[model samples]
Target chain A: AQTVTQSQPEMSVQEAETVTLSCTYDTSESDYYLFWYKQPPSRQMILVIRQEAYKQQNATENRFSVNFQKAAKSFSLKISDSQLGDAAMYFCAYRSAVRYQGGSEKLVFGKGMKLTVNP
Target chain B: AAGVIQSPRHLIKEKRETATLKCYPIPRHDTVYWYQQGPGQDPQFLISFYEKMQSDKGSIPDRFSAQQFSDYHSELNMSSLELGDSALYFCASTQGWGRANEQFFGPGTRLTVL
Candidate 1:
């Protein structure tokens, strides 16, 4: 079983500044994928970014990027130019690279980190 | 592109009562997944369906059942509900066989068991 861990339960970031949320996972499989999801007060789960375990280069989406250190089993999310709307609960999730039954694979998620962006 | 749609944005039930939640996937999406998130908790995978067939199972309780229809819509049925069953239920969908769990989630349905 794969388990994702987000050590920081809460994070505070000033507007226009940068914040890094830490996440680690324990997985025996060599092939897998890592992801970060944002849940706002609306309770919608939004995809922040994703990183493939095989890719050495980190993934970046607009102001969101990730520092994926595969060997250390760590995948951290970096939010640059943080805005007030960035306040939410961030989760780190893990998925197997292998596709199962041609669809709908499940994700194992961390407890989540609450990020607070203040002006 | 339209995202997954979960109907009955909120539902309130009592202990031992039954409830049903529905999900409509994005157009042409063949894979659908269900997740449950308790208050102040991360989402947990429940089950998934592909092509109207059960594809994968997770930590879903035995009292819960789900299935996809030919129209690509899915329904989750919960029986003998308990207070602990109160949570936000989210439905997600993905595209083809090669999809690497790039699922787009729905707005979610909040279920409250009284």
Candidate 2:
């Protein structure tokens, strides 16, 4: 069984500043994927960024990027130049590279952390 | 690019009532996934379909069943619903079972049980 952990229940950052949300996971598999998802008040789940375990290089999407430490089993999201629109519930998720009984892999998510960007 | 579409963005049902939620995946997407998120909680995987076949199951309750259609659309049927079933239902899709393909999510359906 795999599990994701987001220790921070809530975090706040001033607009135009930077904030890093920490996440850790427990998985025996060496190959996997890590992801960050954002859910706004509209209740819509949006993919923020993804990091492949095989790729040591971090993944970045504009202001959103991930610091993936495979050996440490840590994947954290860093938001630079934060904006008010970034205020949302952020989730750290994990997916196995290996299939399950011929079934597709499903995402294992963390409890989630609320990110508040203050203007 | 068109994103996943979930119909009846908001639904209100009473206890023990039956509810059906629909999901239309992005064009050419062969995989569909369903997840449930309770108030102030993270989304939990319920089920998944690949090529219109059940590929995976998660924490879904026995009262809930889902299937993918020939058109790659999926429907989740919930029966004997409980107040606890009231939550946001999300539908996500991916093109293939690739190692790095990310699941694109829909706006989700908010089901409220009264």
Model 1 steric clash total: 0
Give each candidate's fraction of reference contacts reproduced.
0.80, 0.71
CAPRI-style docking class of model 2 based on DockQ: medium
lDDT of 2: 0.92
Q: Could you give candidate 1's per-residue lDDT for residues A1-119 as a string of tens digits?
A: 78899999999999999999999999888878899999999989999999988899999999999999999999999999999999999999998876532323588999999999989
Error of 1 at B82 (Å): 0.8
Model 2 ranges with Cα > 4 A deviation: A99-104
Candidate 1 residues lying further than 4 Å off, grouped into runs, are: A100-104
Q: Lowest-lDDT window of 10 residues in candidate 1 chain A? A: A96-105
- Global lDDT of each candidate: 0.92, 0.92
Report model 2's chain A TM-score: 0.95
